[model samples]
Target: MKIMFVGDVVGHNGRKAFQKYTPKLRAERGIDVVVVNGENSAAGKGFTRKSLDELYQGGADIVTSGNHVWDKKDVLEFIDQEPFLIRPANYPGEAPGKGWCVYPFKAKNIGVMNLSGRAFMPPLDDPFQKVEELLREMEKECDLIFLDFHAETTSEKIAMGWQLDGRITGMVGTHTHVQTADACILPQGTAYITDLGMTGPWKSVLGVQTDKILYRMQTCRPVRFETAEGPSVYSAVIMTIDDATNRATDIERIYLREEEDGIGL
Candidate 1:
């Protein structure tokens, strides 16, 4: 099966890029499934209903999120009812929505789990342990498993990939918005990427205006964060998984050029 997992989509520019390219990308690549990080889909913060619909329309089969999932009150309520939307599993049980879901792709079960790290992030359940437990439960019903490790530290992301190497299909990191160059299969076969990168203007500072970020750092004052605007770029990973082995046989980084016409670019 060929699957494409996109990084975080930041604000209007990200959404536009997604909508403009995703459908054609999927068709041309023969992509069996598509997953996109929607943590910052709404005004570069949290996703809204309208934004969610837009992403769905853009050809994302499932939408994964992170800490910012709860930024919008309305999303919290809808999460309880929506199945495609996923929040971090490491969060407390009382948190809204679910962490893992078993989605069907071409008659095969694909289990997706969202997790968050505690280091330099909100104190949550132990992601390593929590992921193990979730895997054990899903193993009974599904052989294909995908994870979104939304975290800040590269160490945390790489650790999770190594730890879950033979057990899952893939583990793609998000939250940092900066794509890493470590896209490859682990020793045990699972596909892994430290980060899928941001889908907005790569020229900006992690999808946000550099000036505002620098000002806050220099002055120690509070200011609103906004997504950068301009010709956008899309970064993601395309992997061909071996259903028999439940691991990726080949993985490649896809950089859709600025003003590109379709997904294969």
Candidate 2:
């Protein structure tokens, strides 16, 4: 099975790029499923029902989120209704929506899990301990498992990868908005990457307008930032898994900018 994990989608531009490139990518890579991080899909910081629906329409089979998942109050009302949309599992039990789901693929059950890192991030339940419990339950009924760890520190991401090296089908990190160069399979066959990168503006600061960030940096005063408009950059990774072994065999990284890919789309 081939699954494509897209980076965090920012705003209008990011959504446009994703909608434009995903179909072609599926055709080119023969991707069986597409998972996208939609935490920043709503105006670059949060998920609204409309934004989540847009992702579903753009070919996302599952949508994962990180710290910004709850930025929009609307999410609290509709998150529970979306089965394929998930927030970090380590959130308090009262938090709405789940952190993982079992998607039926062909004849196998594909378990998709989302977790957040506590280091340099919001204080949530312990991911290291929480994942083990969730894995035990997911393993019983799923043929393969994929985890999207939305985190800040590379050390924490790498450590989690090592901890679950041979246990899961694939593991990929998100939230940094910067794509890492390391994309390789672990010793135990799990595909891994530090980050999938940002699927939004290419020349801006992490999807925000360059000037807004510059103003804030230069003055040391608060400045409202907005998602940069115009052409976009698409970032993602594809993991190829062996059906028989239920393990990843190869992982491919794809980073494309509209400016170069197709003349600013």
Candidate 3:
């Protein structure tokens, strides 16, 4: 089975890039499933119903999110009803919505799990322990498992990958918004990458306007953050898992941009 995991989709432009390239890429590559991170889909801060619908229309079979999932406030209403939309599993038990889901795919149950790392991030439940428990539960019914670890440090992601090697199908990191070059299969069998990167605002800092971030850094003051405008980049990773063995055989990264950033006169 071929699954493509897209990076965090930022504001309007990121959605455009996703809507524009996702279908084309799926057709060109024969991808069977697409999972996207949409926490920042609403104007680069939070996601809403409209943005969620746009992702579904753009070919996302499932949507995953990170810390910003609740920024919109309205999400608390619909999240529980969305079968395939999941948030980090380590959140407090009282939090609405689920953290893992088993997607039935062609006679196989593919479990997708989302988790957040605590290091340098919100002090949620420990991801290391939380993921282990979730996996044990999912393993009861899943033929393969996929994990999206929304984290801050590379070390946390790498550690999780190592711990779950050969135990899960694949694991992809998100939240940093910067694509890493360490896409590789672990010694056991799991496919892993430090980060899938950001899919919005090709020229801005992360996904924020350059000047806005610049002013904050220069003045040591807080200001409202705005998503950048103009052409955007689409970041994603494609992987192939052997259904019979429930292990990943290959993993490849994709970073698409319409503009030339390296050209110098």
Candidate 4:
């Protein structure tokens, strides 16, 4: 089975790029499932119903999020109803949405789990312990398991990848909108990457307007950040898993760009 995991979708540009490329890529690569991180899908921070619907229409089977998931106050309105949209599992006491879900794909149950890192992030429940609790239940009900670790520190992300190496089908890190070069299969047969990167403007500062971010950094003051415009990039990773063993056999990175003329490459 093959599954595609898209990086953080930044905003309007990100959504447009996703809508344009995901279907073609899926068809060309024979992807059976598509997972996208939509935390920044709504104007560069937080998700809205419209953004979620757009992603679904763009071929996202599961939408995951990170710290920015709650930036939109209205998320509480529909989070419970959307089973495919998930927030970080480590969020404190009785959050609005779930952190993981299992869906029947083909003849097997595919479980997608989301967890947040505490280091350099909100002080939430320990992700290591939270995943351990979920795994006990998920292993019994699912054939394949995938995790999206929305984190900041590479060390933390790498630790989780090693911690769950043989147990899960694969794991990918999100939150940091910069794709890492180290995409590889672990010794225990799990596919891992430090980050999948941002699916937004290629010439911006992590999807935000380059000038705006520079001004904020230089002045060290509160300045509004907006999503960048112009040429966009689509970042993702595709994983091939063994059906019988439920282990990842191969993993490949994807980085495509769309020019102003609407030509993508």
Candidate 5:
């Protein structure tokens, strides 16, 4: 099965780029499933129900999120009703939504888990232990598994990838909007990458306007960050897994350059 994972979708521009490029990519890569991180989908903060619906209609099969998942209060109620949307599993139990879900893929059961890292991030439950427990339950019924490790530190992401190497089919990092150079399969066959990168203007400061970020840093004053609106780029990864062995056999990074035609989506 071929699957595609998109990094953090910034805002209007990001959504447009994703919608414009995803269909072509699906055809070009023969992607069987598409997963996207929608934490910053709504005005570069958190996703709203309407935004999530738009992303789903745009070709994402599953929408994942990170620290900003709860920025929108409406999601507290909407996530439970939507089976394809997931938040970090390491979050407090009282948090809204679930950390993982299982869906039927062809004749096999596929599971997706969302996890958060504590390093340079909000304190959360132990991701390593939580993942082990969840995998044990999923292994009983599912053969294919995908992990979205929403984290900041590269060390944490790499450690988690190695920890679940042989147990899961694929593991990819998110949250940090810059793409990393490490995109390779582990010795145990799991496909991994430090980050999938941002889906908005790469010329800006991680999808935010550079001036705004600079001003805040210089003045040490409160400032609201907005998504950069300009020529952008979209980054993602496509993975092919062998169902028989539940391992990723092939992986490729996809970079889409967006034109300045007022955003495609």
Candidate 6:
């Protein structure tokens, strides 16, 4: 089975890049499932209903999110209704959306789990413990398991990878918006990457307008940030998993850029 995991989509440019590249990439690579991080899909902050619908129309089978999931107040209204959209499972039980889900793919159930890290991030429940709990519950119901570990520090992400190395199908890190050079199969057979990178304007700072970020950094004062415009880049990773063993056998990083003409350059 081939699964493609897209990095965080920042705003308009991110969404456009995703819409432009996803379908073609899927066809070219024979991707069976597509998971995207959409926490910043709504104007670089939170997700909106329209943005979620756009993502679904753009061919995302499941959308995962991180700390920015709640940036939009209306997310509380529809998060529970959207089974394809999931937030960090480490959030409190009363949180609006679920943290993981099992979707049927090719006559087998595939479990996708989302977890948030505490280091340099908002205080949330212990991701390690939450992941263990979910694993125990999902192991029996799914043929393969994949995790989106939204985290800040590389240490935290790497620790999570090692913690569940042999047990899960794959573990990909998000939230940093910068793709790491490491993309390899673990000793235990799981595919891993420190980050998938941001799928937005490549010239900006993490998808934000460069000037705004630079001004803030230079002045040490608050400055509004807006999503960058112009040419965009799509960042993702494709994983090939063995159906019989439910282990990832290969992983490859994909980075495609769009020219000003809206064509992949």
**Top lDDT: which candidate number?**
4
lDDT of 3 at 10: 95
Q: lDDT per residue, candidate 4, 1-265, as tens digits? A: 9999999998999999999999999999999999999999999999888999999999999999999999998898999999889999888889999999998897999999999999999999999999999899898998999999999999999999999989899999999999999999999899999999989888899998889989989999989898898889999999998887888999999999887787878
Per-residue error at 236 for model 3, in Å?
0.7
Winner on lDDT (1 vs 3) = 3
Q: What is candidate 4's local distance difference test score? A: 0.94
TM match of model 2 to true structure: 0.97
Candidate 5: which stretches are off by over 4 Å?
259-265
User: Which whole-number lDDT from 0 to 100 does residue 30 have in model 5?
Assistant: 86
The C-alpha lDDT values of all candidates are 0.88, 0.92, 0.92, 0.94, 0.88, 0.93
Candidate 4 has its poorest 10 consecutive residues by lDDT at 256-265
Count backbone clashes in candidate 5.
Answer: 0
**Ranking of predictions according to TM-score:** 4, 6, 2, 3, 5, 1
What are the per-model C-alpha RMSD values against the true structure?
A: 2.0, 1.4, 2.3, 0.9, 1.9, 1.0
lDDT of 5 by residue, 1-265 (tens): 8999998998888887888788888997788999999999998889887889879878999999999998988787788888989999988768778888887878988889999999999999999999988888888888798999999999999999889887788999999898898899999889999999999787689889998999999999989887888877888999988867778898888877756664433
The reply for model 3, stretches above 4 Å from the true place, is 260-265
Q: Where does candidate 1 have its weakest 10-residue lDDT segment? A: 256-265
Listed per model in order, the count of residue pairs whose N, CA or C atoms clash below 3 Å is 0, 0, 0, 0, 0, 0
Decide which is better by lDDT, 3 or 5. 3
The list of candidate 2 runs beyond 4 A from truth reads: 260-265
Q: Using alpha carbons, what is the TM-score of model 5?
A: 0.95
Alpha carbon deviation, residue 138, candidate 2 (Å): 0.6
Q: List the residue pairs that clash in candidate 1.
A: none
- The true-versus-predicted C-alpha distance at residue 82 of model 3, in Å, is 0.2
lDDT of 1 by residue, 1-265 (tens): 8999998999888998988878777888888899999989998889899999999999998999999998877796588888889999989768879998888877789999999988899999999999989998999988699999999999999999989998888899999987899999899888999999989876578888888899899999999987877767787899898767767899888777574333334
User: On lDDT, who's better, 5 or 6?
Assistant: 6
**Candidate 3 lDDT tens digits, 82-182:** 99999999997689999999888899888999999998899999999998899889989999899999999999999999999989989999999999999
Better of 4 and 5 by lDDT: 4
Over the stretch 1-265, how does candidate 2's per-residue lDDT look in tens digits? 8999999999988888888888889998899999999999999999888888888889999999999998999999998998899999999778899999989889999999999999999999999999999999999989999999999999999999999999999999999999999999999888999999999988799999999999999999998889988778899999998888888999999998777445643
For each candidate, give its TM-score against the true structure: 0.95, 0.97, 0.97, 0.98, 0.95, 0.98
